[model samples]
Target: MNRRMAVPEQPLLRVRNVSKIYGRSCGECMEGTGPERESNICPKCGSIVAGGPISFDVYPGEILCIVGESGSGKSTLIKSLYFDDTFSSGEVYLQNYEEGKTNLLALSSQKKRRVRNCLMGMVYQNPQLGLRLDFTSGGNNAEKLLTADWHHVGKIRERAQELLARTEIPIERMDDCPKNFSGGMQQRVQISKALANNPSLLLLDEVTTGLDVSVQARVLDLIRQIQRTLGITMIVVCHDFSVIRMLTNRTLVMKNGRVVEAGLTDQILEDPQHEYSQILINSML
Candidate 1:
């Protein structure tokens, strides 16, 4: 007797044909540019196609990494997903929102803000972008919680302490300003704040960049720990393949505003098929 197979799990987040363009598009922009053309610039329209026609799905509790060289559009793709910059075209759906039937891009600003505060979190490469240096570490966490409709000061403070401890930020330092903390500590605080609402999805962009090697290791470990403990889905963008290997289950190699290759992290690292991916992997070696 044949047995019924289990249904595939729905993606926590789905992105379709997303693209971001700078300057007036000429329709031929995508056609005329990319890794094939050795540029993200359109020869005909002089517009930069910073990202797109990119698509992917992130499953629940999975860590997906987008790895690329500078100008490869990895950063643009991440920023677009976070709504830091509007995409010129494409659709994004979250399984937690409207059963993944709604195009998030079509939502009003207020609705988008609610989605960000309630369903998603972002950690930028520069701690300054994710943190208000002058705010005490605990205050930063409270701000996120408040945006997510968290009231009650005592509960907020307690939650802040818990998150700070989870991220390995000393509980004693929760009331101190992040501006005075070391680079790693500031990132820990940022991570705590992003996790304040226990978002189902977290986006991290070059998070360990510019940190000392030891500090980067600690931060990376903290990220892994958080994901394991919280079971949060994550999309991480970075130029560093090592970081991808360390944290991601799947990987996308992007170049010239396009995804050149994607697969399990170990598979891509060991036997990349795309020429660009091969070059990238070789360079890392």
Candidate 2:
């Protein structure tokens, strides 16, 4: 019997009124107020609400960019989505998870990890944070495979070779530690590792931050190639407009831990409505 699977008519990922607070609050800090309330510190209770009640959705096969200056809570949102940091209150739902739509904020640590391994992938701004320099390039990829329960040593190495090749890593250098590669090569290794499991949703956090301009363009091209081939849902955290313009179809502009503007990539570039967004465009021009 041929069985058809049921598909959800919801976004691949969704976040509703998400908030991450850093400091302990008295009972009244978030009282009366809600997700609409921004700015981390509570004047009333002296609690630091570092991020959110932020809201946004990522669709399947769409590249969604999050753009903001430093300390605008963009990083916080990225970390929170992956469960690297705790959120004070919110609901996050991932549609592709086999378990059905679940508020990621409510998942247990073990459950969250399984979800991360199966449904999500992340490449951080710094390779040091994502790739273990001590491990060979292929070994790094093996680590990701192992996380997903691939126990056959030979099969794991074969998968690692395929990922490294896909990301343009030299097969001969697969056994060399990332410490010997240039910055761009190191980032490529990180990308290779991140995609080892073929995750449905990929999160890129400032992946091109410190590379030279030419190298940055090349890295972006590689990312675009991967996105086109995989058609995976992506949430890219970046401040560069060129990155947003080249890689994404939709974008969410964040400031002070809130989504100030959101729309088509061109609309945001040509006709930004929010004041902060205007400033970003103006400076670009």
Can you tell me which runs of candidate 2 are displaced by over 4 Å? 1-8, 26-39
For residues 1-285, write the lDDT of model 2, one tens digit per residue: 001223336788888999877677775655523324545567787776556678887777788888887767888888888878888898988886754467787888999999888778899999999999999998999999999989999999999999989888999999999999999999999999889989988999999999999889888988989987887778999998978888888888886666788888888998999888999778865
Reference-based lDDT, residue 18, model 2: 90
Q: Which candidate achieves the best lDDT against the true structure?
A: 1
Model 2 vs. true fold: TM = 0.91
Model 2 deviation from the true structure expressed as Cα RMSD, one decimal place: 4.8
Per-model RMSD to reference: 3.5, 4.8
Which candidate's TM-score is highest?
1
> What would you estimate as the lDDT of candidate 2?
0.83
Q: Per-residue lDDT tens digits of candidate 1, residues 1-285?
A: 011222248989999999999999999999999999999999998999998899999888888899989999998888888888899999999998999999999999999999999999999999999999999999999999999999999999999999999999888898999999999999999999999999999999999999999999999999988887788889999878788778888889999999999888888998999999999889986
| Candidate 1, residue 70: lDDT | 92
